[model samples]
Each structure stands twice: as structure tokens, then as C-alpha cells.
Target: MTDIDPSVYANYYWVSSQFYKFRQEFSDFYKSALLYLAYTSVESLSDSFKLDLAFDLSLSACWEITSTTLESCSHPIIKSLLGTKVEWLYYILQAFNNGDLVRYQELCVYNSALRAQPALVENEKKLLEKINILCLMEIIFRTIPLSIIAERTKLSIEDVEHLLMKSLSVHLIEGIIDQVEGTVHVSWVQPRVLGIPQIKSLRDRLDSWLGKVHTALLSIEAETPDLVAT
Candidate 1:
């Protein structure tokens, strides 16, 4: 990975180190400027695919202030500039860092700013597309035909095969692609954010499992030998 420029990283590091002092040391207007700078830094970090710094910023005082105050201002371009995107970036960084690909996909949508990232520009948004597909695949652990996957992801059959292989190389998912049967046999899916529906699904599975255990206990008790009086 190409290293971030020393000067640029140093500035960001300084900002991070002194984040808590912004309110105490600076005027309201100056604090606003610093918050903007911090937001811009986060976007730049994401563009460079520097996830660590992006998260550091997200957890910084500057990001918290920006998220709370920026939208309330009267500036015309301010809302469009860092308003929705920074908030979204916070979620993106959190989800990505947590390896909650499902949550990342839930938050990841088509955005011009995301497309403008340097890494995305270089790859024609391939990473974002792959991530969206991967999110869907993680939920579809049952065997699914390649044609079905192609339909769900809006990819051609060949593209589906290539995408699955790429995910394998990255260890995003573990499964076998059956070319002859045209099915993907998935045995393992990575853990990710589980929303209400997913949680409900898990509860149902647990309830079923518990029921089976109870029935097994009943059968064992019925087959138990009677004890003689002692």
C-alpha cells in the first residue's frame, strides 16, 4: 500500500490529538472550520482506502461536533458539502471496520461522492459493486443457482463466476461454485450486522433447536430403566 504523505498525515494526527480542545481553545466559528477540515479529512481518507484514519476521525470530537452542528447552519453549500455524506461515512467506516458487511451494504448506496473516491474512480466502482453483491451473497447461504445469483446481482453468468472467485480470494465468503450444476454451495457465511428481521430469523432457528432437544430428552426418559426399591 502506498503510504500517506508525511505532512498530510502529521496534520491529521495533530488535529486528532487536539480534538477535545477545539471548543475550549477556539471560538465557535473557528471550531466550525476545524470540524469542516476534519470532515474533509475523513472523505479523503476513505478515497485513499485508509480505513484506520477514517475511523479515528469518526470517533474524534471534531466528527461528533460536525455531525451535530453542520446541518443546522444557514450556509447554502454546507449541507451539500459535508452534511449527509460525512454522517454516512461514519456509518460506512464503522461497519467496514467491524467487518459487518451486511450493515455496510445496508448503509452503502449509490452516491456521487462515493463514486468520486480515487480508488473507486480507478476501478470504475468495482469495489462498491462487489461489496453490494457480497452483502447479498452472505445472506444467501443456501445453495443458489448461478443464474439466480446473476439475476439478483444484475450480473451476467460469467460475471457472477468471476465475482464469486474474487470473493473467495479475499476470504469474504466460503463456498463452492458448481459450474456443471450451475449452483453455489455455501457452507459458511461471515458474521455481519443483523437487523430486526435477521434477529427474528435467528430466534426462530433457536426455538426449533430447543424443541428438538426437548423431544430427545423425552425419548431418553421414556426408555430409562425403572429403579428397584432400596
Candidate 2:
């Protein structure tokens, strides 16, 4: 196995800091395997592989991002871990077969980074939630009064304000208005997921409510005018 560069990975801080923990316990073979796994995981997310390795190896790792610990496998990462082939025969049938292995691997690394960054995930979740809420309303051209949206969504006014600012800052909404203050903020109204084509590709992979949110904003834009218009 080739030498694994810590810099190439996004989890450099944590993994590098913890490198000593696994260095001695895991044999050279195991270390090599882990490096390969990391390499393959990053690659798999971007490109298909011809080998019959299960794609889930990378996917599963990404899925386990919430956990700080390493995933458990039936076979330990001893000498047997060095090989690239899947331990289970079933996986060979499921994900392998001359596909985008590189891309899959890249995605795994991306997933790892995303998982490690809880703050980022939380921020994104908040942004998506805000987007969905605005989209749900039928008033497309007009802004929904913050108080009304806050009351309807069961979010606090402060939370609504934060989300609105976040959305506007991110350019998800075209314009915004603070009714009480008579302040109108014009922004680039680009939804994170735009149009049906993007929706089709992202719908399955995105959080369920995220799609609902875009729809909701459109609905609100279509149905309601910012009643507080000055």
C-alpha cells in the first residue's frame, strides 16, 4: 500500500491527533488497509469502480459520521484487512461492477468531513429549514411577516429572524422585509435546490423536509402577499 498523506484528508486534525492510538495496535498491514479504505472511500464518492467491492463500505462509513467511534466489522482489521475485496460476498453483487468507485470514495471523505463538522451540519439544517418554510408559503413575490411565520411554524421570533438572515445571506431568497421597521432587504433569490431537474437529483439524497420547504416557499409566494406591506 502507498503511504497515506494526512494532509490529503479533511479529518486531518482529529485523525492525525489520534494517529498514535491506532498506530501501534494496528499492524502495518492493517494500517495500509485503513489507508486504502480512506483512499477508496474518497474515490468512490466521485467515480465508479470496476472491481466488485461493495459501495456500502464507503456509504456506511459516511452514514456513521454521527458516531465518533470507528465502525465495528465482523472481521477484525488484522492481516485480512489489507485486501481491497469485500469480506462479505453479498456486497460484491450490490455495489461493484465497473462504476464510479472514485466518486464514491470522494463522497465518503466528504461525508466524513461533513459528519465531523457538527456546526456546519446544524447550520445547513437550519438554512434548509428556513428555505422550506419560506417556500411553503404561497406568497412568492412578497415576504411573509416574521411574526406570522414564526407563530405558524412554532419557531421563536428570534429563531425566525436568524433563519431569515441566514437565508438572505446565502442568497436563497430574493428579497426580505421587516414589516415593523419598514426595512426591505433585496437579496438573490436562488433556492438551494432549484428547478425540477435539480430536485429530481437531490430529492432522494436530501433530508425529507428540505424538499417540502422549497415547495412551501413557492406556495407562500404564490398565495400570500406580505400583508404588512407599507
Indicate which candidate wins on lDDT: 1
Q: Estimate the TM-score for candidate 2.
A: 0.27
Tens digits of per-residue lDDT, candidate 2, 127-214, equal 3353334432312335456665565445677776765676566555657667586343544444321324434645665666687899
Model 1 Cα shift for residue 203 (angstroms):
3.1
Tens-digit lDDT track for model 1 on 1-230?
A: 47756556556645644563444332343344344454444334443334333323433322222112222222222223233445565555434333355565455455555545453356435445544454445346569888867766666899889878877776667888899999888777655544355578789889999999999999877767543322
Candidate 1 TM-score, C-alpha based: 0.44
Query: Model 1 lDDT vs. the true structure?
Result: 0.52
